[model samples]
Target: MSATEQPVHDHSTAALDHGRRGSLGQIVSWCLWDFGSNAYNTVILSFVFSVYVTTAAAPDEQTGQQVFANMQTVAGIIVALLAPVIGVWADRVRRRRLMLSVSTLLVVASVSMCWFVLPYETHHGLKYLYLGAGLIALANMMQQVAEIFYNSMLVDISTPSNVGRISGAAWGLGYLGGVITLAATLALFVLDGGFLGVPEQDAMNYRAIAVFCAGWLLVMSVPVMIWGPPAPPAKGDARTLNVVSAYAQVFRHLRRKFRTSPQVLGFLVASAVYRDGLSAVFAFAGVIAATSYGMDTTEIIIFGLAANFAAALGAWVFGLVDDRVGPRFVILASLATMVVFGGLILAISATAMFWIGGLGISSLVGPVQSASRTLLTRVIEPGEENEMFGLYNTVGRAASWIAPGLIGIFTALLGTRLGLLGIVLTLLGGLILFWFVRIEGVTHNRSRVTSAA
Candidate 1:
């Protein structure tokens, strides 16, 4: 193979069928992990706990929001600094499954600790609020790191031809899982003081939900751990490198990629910008719904359900299209659609308008995310998957602050409605930059090879 070409390694062998479709059991087992992860994504971060942290935990709404933002920024910085090193370590150790398991356990612990974050009106409320935010930060950092190891396992479970579908299936399953868990929490806890009779005092209902989420995550994670394929054997001695030296190796790897695989570099930069925009869209969706459209907590939960359902459907449907038309097309189309819908949300203030635009924008988010991963998997050099995925996480975290920062600035200067302008602009920026990226040829070649084989 040329320097630019990927080599098939023994790591590819763990899956029952290498260079072909994985077994249904393996695929389902792998996808189940994504399903279980929604406990964190949907309940803890996106819908319930974060909202509580802002509305109940802090001394006031603005202070709480600022504190939350600050903690996320801190988490992003840490992830950016450490993702590459962790990726290098995972690649060297060749134990992505074990690393993922350990990282996931850490996340579960952080999430469960959310129970201790009490309301500001309670004794030591402010102190606990800060503590809660710290735990969230820790959870976010660990979650992002876990994703690097998780994503690297994609190659072991799929072939070049079906990668798009498998990726979409995972993302779709995650959204679906989020919806179910969020609904369960709503039915069992958040609604009518919860059927479980958990006291509403001190927001214990919410705390109980956090514990439930941890257990849900732990349960769902079991299938993958039990049945998912193991990492392929390492090529040589297994010597762990320190963080500083790992970073040095990362720089050298980057240089090599720039020369031999510019597509990977280009996609990384473009995806970073767009992915940040996508995250910002969801991150601020609740706030915008509550403040601008006058949505209450229940209304926000209903809206979240709708958005997650739409995203799940979109991911599954577009995944098949991705394999045929190429991931590049799917990404470009999704980005363009999101940009337009985001503008629609900014333009109209009616609740109906928010629903329409919000769901439209959300529907495309999963497709964009799934396709981006598929595209990267198509182009990356084999055996270096973990490291490259780490860079993916690094670049993403490096730019994570853009949308939030822009939204804050715009909201301060213009108005709450105009804050969405920041998200739209970020998406537009990514769309424009990604337009110049040339990965169609890579996908085309891979398809041909797969077909011939």
Candidate 2:
């Protein structure tokens, strides 16, 4: 084993065991942020706005694809750069809710503005495309910052023993929210041929969905602010800080982690690769359903609902197993399942094959993600969870370009099927790297929750 791969003795897990379980209402309130924030995933990135941009906003099909790629790459870089700073700032503050509220409102405002993209045939479509790109891109960056605080809050809500279950519950509920929103979108607009008799001006159906997404996010985000716990101050002097030194602090903190427990760094790197692949899976699902699977807008939305439902079920079910078998085993199995099903979908050109394999592929998504959070919660020291989760986002975003770049390049040079190959390779590569990294500070003496799912 590599030096970094050796397991650190699990000293911190016990201290985490002492925190109150808190009421189930409180836990659900914390998870409600994830449920609400998923409007970005379902509506903008994966389903509505992305498709609108590439299909209607750009000058033509080819240009639209290129523009979409460039937008994502640029947005990913901005989010990556800002994520650590936000994490550090969040760590310094007494309440993560302050940052969370600002970021959430930005997302809400951005999606609301997307109600204007006209059809590509219109004279104003190109102008709207540029406008949509800027607004959506800004929202995307803010969403990443919001999640850094959202995830860091996990430390405040639960004890170590049930962290996996809580993580999975939040992830599952988020996907459930995705299924509900996608279904509602389909019912209200796409299936009914536009609700409220709104005249079709510039892709009015797609435009209306943007307004709906903003409303959905706004309603769901309020509960977390009202009900979640207050975080203690991070014990740092933030008044004197600037951007460059903020990153330097991150580096120094990571250095300390490396000296004390190299596996933390090792796991961070391993998880980053797979999370990129997972992001691609969500971001491109609707595009693939429409383009490659021969699905109409309504068909695509139905597929989205089914896929997200499967993901929610998988996440909740896997959480039960995670507490028993250990998160290491769960992640290994989840990644392997994704690779198999992702390949299966690419090999078969039929829509039926795509439907079966697409849902299969999605089912694994939540478990790996939820378990990654759980493992990190198991590892990080007391009072530093926010910073560690921030490092998690920073490292994850560092390689964020990998999946999208590979998808863009391979789809151009080879075919769309080859783009699927890029996602597969990311999962495979992460699984390989993760093989060497052990789950930190997993304690066996603690009782495993038998009733978690």
Candidate 3:
């Protein structure tokens, strides 16, 4: 198990053998986690619940935004603090399934709380909102950590040659899952108006969606728990570190790895900026449509479905490009596309070209972002995949505070449309920085295999 010794799983062989084994099924199940988790993102965090809390529950839009922002800030801080430690623990214990189960359950419980969010019950709204926000944050953090382990399992399942395809498939499947779940929820609750006599606007309807998400997550996860191979325990003599010690080890590992390879560090920093911009796209899309374009709930849902569908398409199409050209090229291409479309969104906002331009931009944004993720997967080491992704989430969390905060600030000073310009700036800056990065080392690392299992 020494660094030089080829571990049981050789990177190249695993990558090649990925799909040959039960890789396809395992990868699909793994991606389903994203699908199920995004139910929360789509319904609760991004579109529906956010609007409900800010507009319906809070006294005013300003207060609602403040509350939401504060919750995110707290969540970001907590995630930033704990993620690396959890990652280290996962690597040490090689017990990803247990962690995934715990995290998913928390999400289900928290999301179900949405049932308590009655519009007339404004006094209780704040308390519930705060509680929900905390749960959401914790769930999100746990989900992210589980995702790292899930993705790391990819190396165990697939070979180097098909890693890009597997990664792309996982991502595409995730979007597909989101599309299906969202469509079902929308059809059941919003369009059909009542599941078993529960009105769409009633808390029960929303609760149904939460229940569906929770069930979906739990059910889909069973395959991985049952069929996916378990990671072997850390080698003999490897000491288990506590949370504080784990954090210290993470920082030390970061320094050692980054110092040995500056390119990885550069890629990480650049990816952080762009990833935040990518997140902002989904996070604020509904807000922009609602406030700026006068989009109602139905329109927002339509937009989300369309965007997710486009993302699925993008993942498939750009996946080929990622494998053929190289991850760096695909990443740059995606980022460039995002910048163009994001800028177009800002331009079309003040014109009669709202839906025309908006939909066009929306269409491209999904594929471009999906492509970027595929590219990121191409650029990192296999053994270090989870830790790298953990940092990816960390940098993303750190940058998370900026875009939303800036949007609010700019909106307060300028206008909503103008406020969105910050998003464009972030994307463009990330794209530019990416151009200067050297990817040769990463390419070499990805090509090498150190595992033997």
Q: Tens digits of per-residue lDDT for model 1 on 321-376?
A: 98888777888888888888877777776778889989999999999999998777
Compose the digit string of candidate 3's lDDT tens values, residues 9-39: 2112312333443456676666666666667
lDDT of 2 by residue, 120-225 (tens): 6776446766777777887888888888878877777777567778889999999998888887777777765755665557778778888988988988888777
User: What is the lDDT for 23 in model 2?
Assistant: 71
| Between candidates 1 and 2, the TM-score winner | 1
Task: Please provide TM-scores, in order, for all candidate models, with all chains considered together.
Answer: 0.94, 0.91, 0.86
Q: Residue 360 CA error for candidate 3 (Å)?
A: 4.8
- Please give the CA lDDT of all the candidate structures: 0.84, 0.78, 0.65
Off by over 4 Å in 3: 1-22, 122-125, 200-202, 350-383, 441-453
Clashing pairs in 2: none
Order of candidates by lDDT, top first? 1, 2, 3
Best by lDDT: 1
